[model samples]
Target: MPRIRKNPTGVDPQLLVKDAAKLMPAPTRRLFLRGGASLGALAFLTGCDIVDSASAEHVLMKISYFNDRAQAWLFNPNKLAPTYPDSAVRRPFPFNAYYPEEDAPEVDKEDYKLEVGGMVDNKKSWTLDELYALPQETQITRLICVEGWSAIGKWTGTPLREFLRRVGADTRAKYVWFRCAEGYSTSIDMPTALHPQTQMTFKFDGEILPRKYGFPMKVRMPTKLGFKNPKHVMEMAVTDKYLGGYWEDQGYNWFSGI
Candidate 1:
């Protein structure tokens, strides 16, 4: 069984701020701390001037939002994550989720139908065969987990942008949200959704995606953390509404970009 990862918020506020600060590059970290953006300084920005748990949490969240914005601004939809040769791909990629491995959802492919809704010209549902018949693309990319480990895996699937275009999705929409078979849901910004490397993957390691790795389909996002790449995706929608993710609602950073 995979070890249960603790909630990021279980730590004290000062420690949380310091940990978040580490995510910044060394030079940026130095500048951020020197600019009075440290935890001691953040207490003043929250208008509380007190380091109470509630106020500290709020200040840390604001800084997280600033980090998200910075990452989004630096993201390049055209540039791709570095790919590895097949020989360099990780063997037996690690499995991760909020639950144990034995509890992974069992999808019924025979009866599976991908529901497409929201801002689109055609809200037609799709079958596994229909999705497979769409133009297929393949790439070898690393799946970087928030837990500080990463694995290189080859994936085969349709370009999400092409699939969205076929379904007449509103490309101008602000967000693309997905519902998974295992009750997991998440959303991504429009630009990231259309990124060249963002694929609606059906195969892993050159074979049909096993149930352990999101059978039926998964959104393989190399540019984002593993949790941001949801699995067993069953439904999708294009909308401007902000749908907080399962972890996001629990105070995990919403825009957890790589």
Candidate 2:
């Protein structure tokens, strides 16, 4: 038989609550603590026992949902993530993904086609040349990762909202999901997908995006954590259904706001 921990720790409940609150974002944590709810009370509210892994996961899931709702309520679509000066742009912006940099998928520039579908009037696939011809803009923004590091980079791309508009997307949809060439996928709430800063990046640092940094294309979302920004995207769909992301399904929060 496996031993089960009766208490999360030997620490007092109040102290545990205080320490656990650090896991939450600053704003959400403040709001959560405003009612001065006890740790036991909170656990009960989640309908989970703290006795085992399954019950503990249930509690954590509830907390994640609470955090998600809090962030959704606080999010302002019009508010943009901070932009940095060109001089502050990090040279050789770090390459990050579930796979090693050398293992990044090699997209054939001549054969790549972005398949767009779901809740859109135009479901036509687009080539890199076609996408490049769309109105382009540039922004220097910081990419905040869940791993506790960030880098500023200049990304050149078509505003995602504009592309969606041209495609006659249902802007009122609940979510937008992307599937990448490298077997990674993620989703964003509609508000974040349509945010002015959301971009379909094709270039980095005044050149074609290198393979290590997502060769054919990437969906860059400054408002979201790094993992939310999928790279080497091959397909996209706008939907009202809950399409969980790779990380989200594995316990990361679905609405992973920065």
Candidate 3:
């Protein structure tokens, strides 16, 4: 039997457990609550005595990793996210980012080029016109944010799978990593990268994507929470490496599928 140590002075063990639960993404939290998991159970499962915040954090991170794997395994690659009509699209879509809207990167479209690398046969950089020339599709899907707000918006872009095929990307690669002009970065599993609803978005609301909404280009994934959809995308790489994202590195789940 695993030994459970008493928590430090003034620290409520129950509160610690509740705090850990709150750190989990919504779906994971629901599953955790449904299972009736508790601090003692977590310590027993991890074989670690949670005597302090450090130990508690260690245990919670392990559970988070487990949740990530479970979500990824259960993800249905073929299932499409629900789409709405233009009438359902939110007017003046809310602008969101880590920084203020005025601070958004101002990308000059004429000089912008998307640099592609890694396991793709064509490591060529593509210009705006070139990307726009690709077969484009539009979807009015809900953008679910981890912060709990959601908005329906129309996005138009090349289907990511089609773009990957055009670039001769290795479909078997483990992950597709992206770099944004605003110093944000994120990665997604190959399955998510190939999802039909995942797009390399160039237009929003039938207009060239505005600076406030990731001008030039954004990797839009209706299947993922808003943070996972990188805007102002400048570069991408297909690789087997696990390049963690900005939020993910800070303890947010890596496989944040919705």
lDDT of 1 at 51: 52
TM-score of 2: 0.81
lDDT of each: 0.80, 0.82, 0.84
Clashing pairs in 3: none
The candidate, 1 or 2, that scores higher on lDDT is 2
> What are the runs in model 3 whose C-alpha is more than 4 Å off?
1-51
TM-score of each: 0.80, 0.81, 0.81
Q: Model 2 over residues 1-258: C-alpha lDDT tens digits?
A: 111222122334454344334445434432333334465687687786443345556777899989988998888999999998999999978877654455567888888899998999999999999999999999999999887889999999999999999999999999999988756789999999999999999999999989888878999999999989998898999999988887787678889887
lDDT of 3: 0.84
Candidate 2 total steric clashes: 0
Give the CA lDDT, 0 to 100, for residue 136 in model 1. Answer: 82
Per-candidate alpha-carbon RMSD to the true structure: 8.2, 11.3, 11.2
In model 1, the Cα lDDT at residue 91 comes to: 80
Q: In model 1, what is the error at residue 68, expressed in angstroms?
A: 2.1
